[model samples]
Target: MDKIQHQTRPVFPFTAIVGQEEMKLALILNVIDPKIGGVMIMGDRGTGKSTTIRAIADLLPKIEVVSEDLFNSHVSDYDLMSDFVKQQLQEGVSIPSEFIKVPMVDLPLGATEDRLCGTIDIEKALNEGIKTFEPGLLAKANRGILYVDEVNLLDDHLVDILLDSAASGWNTVEREGISVRHPSRFVLVGSGNPEEGELRPQLLDRFGMHAEIRTVKDPSLRVQIVEQRSKFDSDPYSCIEEFQDTQKQLKDAIIFAQSRLHDVTIDYDLKVKISQICSILNVDGLRGDIVINRAAKAFAAYNDKHEVMIEDIKQVIILCLRHRLRKDPLDTIDSGTKVSQVVNDILG
Candidate 1:
């Protein structure tokens, strides 16, 4: 136990992170409502993208899962359980469970589809008449966050496979006609540097929200960030302890927002206006509108409001719509600026 504890790395607290408010907001909104899909964060190197994402994971409240379940099957939610667990439950088996931190899975850039999606043991099936499915990263990420760093450097085919599973909330693997399908519901967070490469336009649109972050240009803020990181590096446990109270507060806020998200209401007029903005921007599909609605409600709930306010929509609209806009080679303005301009014109 001592060795295990020593091997585990301590995380910097989410509340202790400085600057990059937009990126933080995007992640928080997604946590409040995974149906808002997931956030695509594009930023320069060493902007704390990975650190912030990991901190968010560490800061989340624990969830109960079936004991010894490969998929982290939810203790009660049937939809969140894997096929094997569901079968066992249906057969009247009482499952033992334990609480665990929400999983944060990092997808390596070189991971293959089989490695990510798992595989079937056909020989075992033939010999023993038991379908032995090897669980993969997707199985481990169920009801959790699947993070891909430097996502732009990943193969587009693999990215598509991941997006498909994320959108469908399930992953099915087949080998020689023997198949296994499992719940794969997860918030798919992808971060990459534009200096590497850009995801295809169609692929980029699949993400629910896009947040852009930059290196701190202000000297004082940069110094502060550096100092904070230095402190964390020197003594991670003490640094995390220093912000435990704020971390609990933020975690509580997230839990409250998630519980209240469905109860939060949006006005018909607001919906119409959101669609109008999407139309004016010529967003490819209804995804932009839907994401905006979900994200706005999440923002409202996060602020402890039961009714969606324009301010709530304003806070999330750019994140939802920026990446969906058609590329304009001749246009000098960034997509975020264009989104804000349209929102102002329409909402005003």
Candidate 2:
């Protein structure tokens, strides 16, 4: 639709948000480098976990998308496009482009399997006597953010479907004598209160980084947070306008980071340091190293730097490796302290 129609949707301004710095940083890191996988936020309810994520859409710069593409595919980078579509481009067909709003699809807890994975269009199939594929939430979330709140309570089958789509960057359907596959390469974001339930380990591993959010206990900070939120709730439109300049600056920073990400280089010494820490800690899988490297690079890019440094790697290590590391057997040490120890032992 038109710009006015699109702008009607309400979004909380990122700068105006209160507390939850860790949650905000982790989410921004993912945006800077989606290959770091996605961010998982675990916290108590009403800590702004969901609000911070939803506000990300407002902070992001609009992307150039393919005209008439259901998935909002990026015209500039067709990395996730199907082989069939790629072949069409090779055959000299002109691919059109349109500037559209970036997607941020929220998958609710009450959604069903059929609604998640495309179900057979019974009406169309029966009327035409031919199987037709109806797209689902995954399809709608392509090349954007797929947010799942209360993720710990998601049904097992749906969790499997989400994991499969995330792993392969595509969703495949086979039913009623019809088969279809489409790109489903959205960044997976999940937030939930751990007291409700623990996330399945398999699904948990899909998240590249995790952050724990807690209510701010500082009296002055808490008061400021409450007052700001109350005023925004009372006059969201004017409050957002007041914060528009800050939002624009953040949007520019993200755009600049995305452009510089490719040019950013990591030194071999820093890579070795990253590997040494993960190896020393006996962390499983090479994914930790990959995430650490990507997170560091993104951090450097966010700072408008061309080279990754030990400081950047160290800054994000807790968020990057916290969820991946096994629990200490002693149970006496805090995770942050343990992480710091590992960093100090290696980097010092």
Candidate 3:
């Protein structure tokens, strides 16, 4: 018990986060299908956005990575590794592995390029005058979640760097004659208060799903939130313990869903429906249609369904289409509302 206590710390339970159902579903769907790409969450301040994401960190299952690999490369991704790592593996070198929690890295708003990327090892520079590259947040976030709080406030250059890394699933550092490349596949999670600012188009369009979270407004729900939060604050350990079983169930569900997602078939009708919805919205690119199809399949997987359904597509319509809508100068309605209207006109 003593050793176990030292091994882990209590976190605010995912189940304990009250309301924001859509946001929670969005995160879960991403977990089920990271190929749906990443998620963008827009909400007001103090709305449990960060806490909910932090809660996700605790709920995730541990991953296996090649031992001594700084980038935490998965065994499956070993063949696609950098030339040096690959050569070592081909020489019958003993590659060991250990299990670790899926890394969850926070991208600070004021981070510099070097910090977001990385620099040379100090010991190598001092002892041998050799520049050995070190890993940064992108490296740490490989095969994990790269969470950016207040993403709208990030510098334009930093956002561009992040977008590029996300799109390519790799980060390469070439400055100072230290060339290093590593896989950086991560589920990008960006949350910002829209009132503060708007995300740039390039970065925003990359996200596959977007959710607008509102503060708990119902009196009963608010009371429940206050009560659960106060109880968790008073005794965090017990609170987390109470929800441990539920968290395990969700974690297992995610693992199972991932295994079965590939087999979950989509028919031609569903493809036509998704395309029709995207066509109605006049979304900029094929991303909208692709996201809708992927998010629907993910939604089905989450519900243990082996096939996509119209209801599943409807469930994720706003999340997949809200951020993809083209701006209309004369239109005053919210994008989510417009998406819903279009979905109704087409699907209903």
Which has the greatest TM-score? 1
Model 2 scores worst on lDDT over the 10 consecutive residues at 1-10
lDDT of 2 by residue, 1-348 (tens): 233234676677999987787788888888987788888899988888877888996678777777777667655566667544667688988988788666888898999987887777767776897767778899888878899999889987887888778767888877766677878987789888989987866567678888898888999999998898888788777778888889989888988998899999999988998999999877788888998899999999999999988788888998887777676577787666777899988887
How large is the C-alpha RMSD of every model relative to the true structure?
1.9, 2.7, 2.3
Residue pairs that clash (backbone atoms under 3 angstroms), model 1: none
- Residue lDDT tens for model 1, 225-324: 9999999899777777788789999999999989888899999999999999999999998999999999999999999999998999999999999999
Quote model 3's TM-score: 0.93
Instruction: For residue 138, give model 1's deviation from the true position in Å.
Output: 0.2
Q: What TM-score does each of the candidates earn? A: 0.97, 0.92, 0.93
Candidate 2's clash total is 0
Ten residues in a row with the worst lDDT in model 1? 1-10
Worst 10 residues of 3 by lDDT: 1-10
Q: Which tens-of-lDDT digit does each residue in 1-348 have in candidate 3?
A: 343245366678897788899999999988887778888999988889988988887788888888878888776576335445676778977778889988889999889998888776766766798868877899888888999999999998888888788778889888655577878888899999988989977679999889999887899988999999999899777777778788889888888888889878789987997898888888888988888888888888878999998889899989988888777779989999998997888778
